[model samples]
Target: MLDFHTLAEFSRANCVSICAFLVPANLLATVLTIILTALHRPLHQIWQAAGFASIFALIMVMHVYSWFAIGVVMLPTYILLWLAITCLLANLIAILWRRRFVNTPSLSNNA
Candidate 1:
């Protein structure tokens, strides 16, 4: 269906199309997660987590392709995905450390 000259080109075109939409959708959700996590907004954390899970599901579905096609389509896309995941992980670690350090149990209870 795509306007490509060869079968390989057609497959790459399909991959590019799928990844094109997936990349930005993932990024926006990640940014939202970061903001929500940073502002201590737990209200939407569940929903955002679902969104993140869905993105991964989509990526896994895309992984059905052969390595050759993947190599063609997943250059900058995977890089961006890795960066987003790293940011999310860092945010989660920061949040955990903040809670632990800020709300420590009193060492010496004045009995």
Candidate 2:
């Protein structure tokens, strides 16, 4: 099992590869989930849970107590981030369609 420092060093050495791309992407997904939740979207609980899991992993890593293989840790992060972003986009599109076409009045409908 690698210590956090060792893992950090390894990640730094390969920063241009997967770690560099994923860390920012995960963080961005977390932020997007939080934003969507704040807006009272459909992904409230799922986003909260995924965000909590990521935060827990990040805290564990920061404290040097994380023991999972890097791939093990990263794979779930990627999956959850992708899921959250996809759900958020779908919810946004649904809301926009409802507001523009379903809820709002149109001249054609009046005619």
lDDT by candidate, in order shown: 0.53, 0.49
Best by TM-score: 1
**Cα lDDT of model 1 by residue, 1-111, tens digit:** 753246445545586675666666655665665566566555346345536645653553443243335464556655644655654564455456445544566577644
Please give the range of 10 consecutive residues that has the lowest summed lDDT in model 2.
60-69
Q: Against the hidden true structure, what lDDT does model 1 obtain?
A: 0.53
Model 2 lDDT tens row, 24-94: 65566555554554555554454454555455345334322222434345665455445545544544554
What clash pairs does model 2 have?
A: none
After superposition on all CA atoms, what RMSD does each candidate show versus the true structure? 7.4, 11.4
Q: How close is candidate 2 to the true structure, as a TM-score?
A: 0.33
Residue 100 lDDT in model 1?
56
Model 2, 109: alpha-carbon shift in Å? 28
Off by over 4 Å in 2: 42-111
Highest lDDT against the true fold, candidate: 1
